[model samples]
Target: MADRLRVIQWATGNIGTRALRAVIEHPRLELAGVWVSNPDKAGLDAGALCGAEPTGIRATGSVDEACAIPADCVLYMRQGTDIDEVCRLLASGKNVVTTRGDFHHPAGMDPALRQRIEEACLAGGTSIYSTGSSPGFVTEALAIPLVSLSRRLDCLTIDEFGDCSSRNSPDLLFNVMGFGQPIGDFDQRQADHVKADFAASLSQLADGLGLVIDCWQAHGEYAAARTAAPIAAGTIAAGTMAAQRITIEGLAAGTPRLRFRANWYVSRDIDHPDWDLRESGWRIRVTGDTPLDVGITFPVAPEHYAAFTPGLTAHRAVNAVAAVCAAPPGIRTTVDLPQVLAHLPAQSSAHSSENLPT
Candidate 1:
């Protein structure tokens, strides 16, 4: 029996809760602590929160308490990032692998903020990185190998199609997303955020390949529902925004090199003439010497969509803990760390831990 990595599950929300369960079940990882924002969740056993047996460790509401717990790494899954809190954990010498979008690319980050995080990492000699399914996986991870298959490159586009019909949140679909609102134009602020968010990952990708992206660009379009359509969230009336596609691109020498397009819709029955909307999945296309188009489909049925969706993000973060911990202290991007490998529970018993690539 060798030493297993001690991991703290920070903030037990949707993705956080999923990470918490994974940390408990993972054979090579041990659950060190659980941090919860909700006061009611505190004092409860960590396992009980995730529908598992009590594991002796209890949830705590205080960030100070979470940092004080001696651990190797923290799987940070908080809804929104708190820089001060994140710095505190790093300063306490605990490495962090987060789903938050803040630390993806150091150069793309605000100069002052990147310096602050780098200082914290240097002070504590720890490492931190951000990753997840869409911006993390589809935007960067999957594209890395595809680009290797080409010499002369024209453009690479990653398309993410999400059918929100199975999502049961009315407020998220209607008010927050403006999905059921009359089609005029997509919100500018959201468009700006989208541009900035995906730009971070794309810039990191370009940097990894020794290519420089001169700038990032964004464009958005929408389609109105042709008729009233019922969804799990609720009913979307006719003449409202039923589908939206936002494309963000990275330019090199004024030429678009890297691109990501997100297609979200409540129904395929929209007013658009040639819009291709389908279930949740990703398609990555490369136009180059070796032209390639790869389609990744999430085979889960509609009823089980929510059940399996979180893993697309959570599992990667959980699996990345050891890789980030072994990485040199600083802001490590997907490009910086070694290949993150998954150590399933079955693998632990069937094979020796030494078999894992270092």
Candidate 2:
């Protein structure tokens, strides 16, 4: 217990809040410091932000203050990717585990930016990793093992289905994601960013399988609501885009090999005829000599989804702290690191190691 890794929680948003509480509760990690960009959040007890018991750690808004703290790892779950801030953390001798989608595949990143990140890693002898529930887990972590069973692999596709009806964030659903907007109002720039994000992830998968991806392609499609539908986020007027699907493919020789499709919908009363949107879950289909189909569903109810979603993304990144800290200096992908061992809390009486398979 005394040898626990000192960790700094670098944000206090939804995902970051979960991570902050997790770092406080994790037996293998010590809460070294906390950082917040919002001045109002600064000077507050770390526990006050995440609803945990006060641990005497106050949040600071200063970059220099965060970097000066001697911590083994920094849990950076900020909303967007701040390259300069992240590089500073890396060069300050603290390994980073982030939920940002940018650093998943270093090879797919801008060559100059990749080199800059690597240089910071090498300078501090630290490592940085990006992970989350969808892009990190269902795509790469789950896809890797399934594809390994195929000696003659053809194509692997990941279908991620999410129901955002229960989410009450109108800004996130309508303004940011362009969900309730008219068909023609779909933002091309946002679509491009989404495409770029998924392309990067799919490319990482291809890189791991040793598949030569000649090109990466991305496509975004939408389904309009046929009638007005009331949901938690608000009403979706008829003819407005209600559902969105962004598919990213890694192709070789003009053939698709690795693919990922994100299916997010607020209402089922839509215009897509062929698409059969499943519940909130994930499906992986591997086409090969030993083809495999797998489905992972979130059993949590819609009302409880807001509370449930953060853990899916935050916990994995928190669990990977040990592996990230141990990794060599650079951007570590799922293939680069060992299988993330989720060291869960031990049971006391009814169930213990005796019940676990050796």
Candidate 3:
């Protein structure tokens, strides 16, 4: 173990770029290698992909080559990739910190995956942890504080309403929500018990709150422009709108009442952005016994995006770096490791930590 932990960054997208920059800035982590899917990216300088100084690490799509590097951990930001590959890497006795959807579900996730990682950790004597903004930081960091106010657990709720015009890339917009499809067709495709990212996050929330879901249901809503609204590259589906909301109950089957809601909405002017200014992000509300009720809203700021998203992510990455560098390796969530709650500064007065349970 050295003073600075070595890190291999997977993916080269927006979040990946952010994570890469973060690892560069962190005093305790070094960028060991870059993993990419494009053949052209292979053999290229990792720093070049991110417009940073050369670290001499080459970008390659070979997982084995990347894993073979003498590094302590992998800081993963790759999306739509299988957890099995990540699990294999972790099982090889390398620590993994990923933003993948499935790994954050809960402690008992896939029995095989859990067993493999545990075995590796026990054998290698290392640690692994996974986290992100929505499921990672918001669900755990934010929810843990609310726990203090409740004597008995009841339910929890989180809502993220944002304008992704500036943040989201083209591939993400169409692929995730079927954005380009006709509303009729898109609605029909998503009508059934189709699981999504929000479901996984809800599961994480339940796990964080120590609740076992008896049953869960997810819903979606869409509204096209009542009238045409201008957007990048000409009109986009004439006021295209897509939203998904899911609720998972902790109560047993046939229980009287069980309530929870996790929602994601992307629309052009859903709230009429303060055109005079810029405002975006979420309003999070949590409730439990002991009159626990508080709503938090962080308006989007152009300046904050650069630092806020990755800074919060870096905090989680740094927290996971130790585990990823140590013996036990496999996909693990924040709940699996020591809590990162203590590391964050107390929220300002507008957000109180007064009633939290000891």
Q: Residues 1-358, candidate 3, lDDT per residue (tens digit)?
A: 3587778888877667766755665556788888887788889887787666777878999988887877777777776756566655665555777766556664546787667666666655455566777656766656666665766665565555444544445566666654433464334335334344445555665666666776655445554544454443233455455434444444445441223344443444432233111234444454546545555455435434543555455446656676545423444555556554222323322212222222
**What's each prediction's TM-score?**
0.93, 0.91, 0.73
C-alpha lDDT of candidate 3 relative to the true structure: 0.57
RMSD to the true structure for each prediction, in A, is 4.5, 4.2, 7.4
**Per-residue lDDT of candidate 2, residues 1-358 (tens digit):** 3599999998889989988888887778899999998999999999899877899999999989989999999999877889999999999899999999989899878999999999999999999998988789888888888988989889998998988888899999999877889897445565577777677777888887889999877777889999898989899999998999878788899999888888999988899967778888988999989999888887776666667778888989999999999999999999889999877654332322122331
Q: In model 3, where do residues sit more than 4 Å from their true spots? A: 82-84, 106-108, 164-201, 204-210, 224-228, 232-279, 291-315, 323-331, 341-358
> How many Å off is the CA of 151 in candidate 2?
1.1
Pick by TM-score: 2 or 3, better one:
2
Model 1 misplaced regions, further than 4 Å? 347-358
Off by over 4 Å in 2: 170-181, 226-228, 237-239, 347-358
Which number leads on TM-score? 1
Taking all chains together, the TM-score of candidate 2 against the true structure is 0.91
- Arrange candidates by TM-score, descending: 1, 2, 3
Clashes of 1: 0
